[model samples]
Target: MTIPLVTVTGKSVDDKVTVERTGFEEILPKLDGNPDTSSDDSVNPLERGTELRVTVQSEVYQAWGSVFEQRIGTDVDYDPSTERVSFTLDGPPTRGPPITRAAFSPRGTGTHIGKFAGTTCYRPTGGSSCTAADVYLKSANDGFANCFTIEGDLVVERLPDSGSLYGSPGCGGAVIEGQSFFGERLSRSSAYEIKGDVTFEGYTNIRDRVELLEAGGGVHFKDDVRIDGKVKKMRGVTVDGSLYFDQGSSSNELKIGDGTVIKGDLVAHGRIKVSDTVEVHGEIYTTNRKITESGGGDGLVDETGNSKPSSEIHKSHPLSQVRGEMRRDLTHMITSDRPGRVDMSAKEPATGDPAPDLTGATLDCDADGTAETCRLGAGTYKLDHLILGHGDELELDTSGGSIKIYVEGGVEVPKNAHIQVLGNNPNQVEVYVEGQGAGSDTFHMYSGSGAGGKVTTPQDKASKFWVYMDPSDEVRLKQDTSFTGVIYGPGNAPDGDGVDIYLDKQSTVKGAVVGNFEKFTNLATVKYDATLQNKYALAAGGAARGQVAYLRTSARVVSVDS
Candidate 1:
């Protein structure tokens, strides 16, 4: 293979030397009819508009226009005879006068980023290095050979004793101030600096970050606030409405007035201390310090999926945490208890089985309902109906096993013995007893000191009733009272409503006669037959001292709900 010798026409170089583009130069690759290895005068790459292989050696480089090739004449002295190339430059360099604080046309192309002659007046003293000047950057197309430009003499004079550098009375128009000025947007009379405040009538957007040394008055943002500063202090930084610090922001101190309303979430890595109350419409979660509120409703939800009353939940944790804690507490209460309530309102198909008569029968619940035994085992015991003997106690002792007592129709425990129904979940226990057959009665849960015997009265629609008691053997009913399965017959019981305790004709009612009663006037000395039917009230032999009572009439007696 033949060697590829690269060379430039006007410039000769050693065999190891290479031609390349320098800083900010754009170069195009060589194409057909381009410079050859033995060419004399090199054509300008820009004028020829031919692709050229230029070694890139700088951070930026460029070369692309056909105009550069025309500038190189065919007989022009080219340095490297091994290469032929051409190029041309369109025009001479154009420069502009140094711009002062006075107004000037920023329309035409001009050198901007150059040393301008102006008194370097205000040299910040308190360790603040900031030069107050109308900075005009060089045009994009202009070659930035010099960074500073001065039409007059270069002077470094001490700034006159001035209190403030910007927005002062005499310093008006000297400060290039406006709400984001641009090329065609320069104001003619609005010199660089002005006397009055630099009013950013609308939103003032500085594409670059803004740094404030020390602002006396508060910096207000009708829209948003984005400041990068080492330390910022103000009486109050008020956002027109909501305030949001981006995720990356790490503010030292952020405080809101007493009644400030935040409609969004607040996330901060540093410490956030609220002086007074803080009302957030969204969730509030903090990983660092404490979050507090002065006073408000606990509109929180508990994990039970229950909407806790605003008056109950404490204002310590977030709503989610509060809810979780509540659910945990409830679960402990239900599972931890020795006998928790199992609402069996959904179990048991209704069967027309008669109530089990216990008048002359005895059962050892511990013997699997077959024989009498003291140790009751774990299993479900079904009694279609229960009829307590005139005077008997039902003893059920299940120490090692979990037993379930279920009565189909209802349960009636003689006032004599104490009854108990129990079960367990994974070793824990549950109890339920319902009374039935009669009107309505409650399950008497027997307590040690007459406090545990509970009588659960089933609703009129439900067939059975319940009585969860805790006694073992002996007990007795009150003299004139009888414990019925569904309804406890405290005959002529004075505790019932007046309308439910009325007396029959044989026994007069001295107090109010409350139950609904109908009078009859259609009996004309009726005669009796072989198949005769008659009804009569037993006579009270002359001594008619009435009793005070109420009877349940058309209205069925209703048990008071706890």
Candidate 2:
């Protein structure tokens, strides 16, 4: 329930300490009640040796999303000059978590620290979790707990006799919206125009303003979903619709290891096994016969059966449809027998010249190159097997224009091999890897780049370097390296297996990604650049099926904490 907002690393002197975090908005200055004292626009610092207990709580930063948790430490100070916060503490240890960073405010003075009776116990579920807020009325305790977080989706097993989550979720009459209660659905009272299935480049306060619009329900969400870089609650908002991330873009996530986050609806093909740690952001739409509970039951509890609910858990769908028997709506296949999900037949190697092998040659396309540097200029180059292995330096000069390379065989960029894009425009280079067989068509983006050949583009311009893989083999973003580009792959034929991209635990991707299959051993944080989508869809003269996206909503006004 507590996040070491930012750990307090160490203490310098007894009265002064150091923190490992930054970005303090002037520790909430003590709420002085004096009137008309505008002359001194300065905080009245705590008197010397005044052992102050500082609760460095998170303040609002719409840009950073939301600070959903809290951490505590003692003794705080803010320097206006450096604009940083310092701390004084009861030196180390006897502790839970290290003190986090914060602006100066008397500990426990904020409304967030209010003492209210709570049950952490949930009911029929279905309630929106708000920020550290003291709601307008009695308390906030629907399946969505009070100020505290509930970890995953809250589903109503049995709506209280009131037939609503504590009478429209205790936020008083305000529209529970913004990055805090994003994708959440409530019963009545004031409602935010929250649009489900948001294909967002960014989210606005007005949730309905996005490209997609639909109310969500009747789906089962599983696992912890973390939006990389978007400051959010531990338990993310349940999508009334679906966590259809980016129909166009994929996710670079902190879904951790085996930590899959399914936001909105879930319709599995067979019996759904609910794990102990598995969290649902929405209701599970399956017959009691179709679902089973494993592990200690915190995820799904049945009040009626005292074990698993006999009735199906749904958001809005009718029970008769899901409870009696598993119908077609509840059982379906994701990979239906279909041919060619993507349109890749349009762009083929222009029939012009026989493929040239750039195995050991340092062929410079324009200027005279040294023995080690191979320069490629702005032109359509067709190659059979391109292996710029160890000691090969290939320079793609896009200053003249865009460079398109069509390969008929496998391409390998091994250790010590480097490919540099000598251009600023993001959409300047294209490399399509397509060969006769699967192994021959493999695009080895990473082949023992033992800590080398880290290719990057100016974040927003990540689309500048495009790699097309017809039947993608594998693209691994090695550890300690950052990548910025679109990894396009597969699906031009009915028998194709779609796209395949592998990501390393420590690797970070900055652009878009579309693959039929993705593997993550650890957390892969992707800071997506939305601009790449347009250029991707237009690649190969607008015949490209689509690109990927890591939807990042820019900072906008979600609400004003009163």
Model 2 misplacement above 4 A: 1-346, 350-371, 437-441, 447-449, 458-460, 477-482, 492-496, 538-562
lDDT of 1 by residue, 1-562 (tens): 0112233335444556544444231132222222222234432222221222322222212221122223322122232333433332222112111112211111112211211112121221134532222222111112111112211111111111111212222222111222222111122222111112122222222211122211233233333222111112222233342333222233343433333333333333223445343344434343334533332433222333343345432233443442232211111111111112223443232432221322212233321323221222443455544434323334333343333445544344333333332322122112233334433322222222222222221111101122332111111222212221111111122211111121111111101111111110111000111010111111001111111111111212222221
> How far off is residue 205 in model 1, in Å?
10
Model 1 RMSD in Å is 48.4
Compose the digit string of candidate 2's lDDT tens values, residues 102-176. 000111111121112111111112255322111111111222212222111111111121212211123221122
How well does each candidate superpose onto the true structure, as a TM-score?
A: 0.20, 0.36
Report the Cα lDDT for residue 358, model 2: 42
Error of 2 at 355 (Å): 13
Score residue 453 of candidate 2 by CA lDDT: 44
